[model samples]
Target: MPEYRRSLDIYQGYNYKKDKQTPVGYLTKIKVAGTDLTVDQTCKDPTNPTTDLKCVAVLSGALWETGVTDAVYLSGQVSAPNRQTLASLIINSLTSVEVVYQFAVYDYDPVAKKYYLAFHANQTDMNGLLEKRGEDLNVSVADDASTEVQSPINYSFQIGIKPQPSAQTLHIATADQKNVVKSWGLALG
Candidate 1:
């Protein structure tokens, strides 16, 4: 069996404005391709810091302050077969977002590796202006292949509720809660 490993890429200390109409901090934004897609937004305190000042163990302590917070946007493209479905996707607000996805298409040559965009359902909330609306485009992936994946696959993620901090991580696994939760690389023990 190929050993499966997961890693994260983080960009630290991006700034944000608290008083904006959209409280979610948007550090940077990037446009994806000929189609409409974008990334990089805001982050918020998911929960109270684990420990107090005496021995603070907050995962995102620095950002917990009520004022300004940092944000980071994800960048990638979306690909789908003729069909489009609106799906609720959960991404790591702090970098440990997990989901089950399928490969939109199979590779023609096993010797060579290629990446393609996966399609996902778009909910009714889509503001009509999807390009700048901050909606994520789901990328379809195969569960069987993903379960046995040993390396990171290039995927187009749906725009998360907020921009994930650099400290956050991404996980892809089978949709089954058991497999999805268990197969994650950055799970909290």
Candidate 2:
């Protein structure tokens, strides 16, 4: 079997307003490409923080306030007879993979003049692989017997804010919850 390296790309979308917009809300789109898909790691326990945990990529200057959503595998090579089985396998494996996010929340009560901070996280097992979009999986096979077949597949996700108590919300609120915002604000002096 041939070995392939995984390549991942993340894209972020934002909305800016003249003066009314909060300038805090945004969305993230992730694309992962690789071959012989398999689950590298399961969901991590929230109480335990380890280096082995798989975390959603955090971008600079932006707070990830949402868990991954709308995760799906897409391919243009699945329709090919030779690639169908591989595509099916990839899809099946991805369905078992779980993506999780960790974040913090900061709540302020103006009337009471009190502030509350909390940490939160959540995970979602990919169960929607059965839905197929775009062309079937297709990839070129090595002709030489000594050469291994190389198959590439693509998966995507939409990471965004959810309701309160969710991981996304926590992540978005981390800066405020941790008082990083206050520290940074003063550092500007």
Candidate closest to the true structure, highest TM-score: 2
For all candidates, the clash counts are 25, 14
Q: What is the per-residue lDDT of model 1 for residues 28-51, given as tens digits with 9 covering 90 to 100?
A: 222222122222222222111221
Off by over 4 Å in 2: 1-50, 54-121, 124-126, 135-189
Cα TM-score per model:
0.16, 0.21
Instruction: After the best TM-score superposition of candidate 1, give how far the Cα of residue 175 lies from its true spot, in angstroms.
Output: 34
Task: Please identify model 1 stretches exceeding 4 Å from their true place.
Answer: 1-69, 81-83, 86-189
Writing each residue's lDDT as its tens digit, candidate 2 over 1-189 gives 211111211111011122221211111111223223222222222122131233222111223222243221211111123233344444553432222223222233344343333222223221212223344322222222211112222222222222222222121122233432110001112
- Cα lDDT for residue 99, candidate 1: 25
Error of 1 at 131 (Å): 14
The Cα error of candidate 1 at residue 7, in Å, is 20
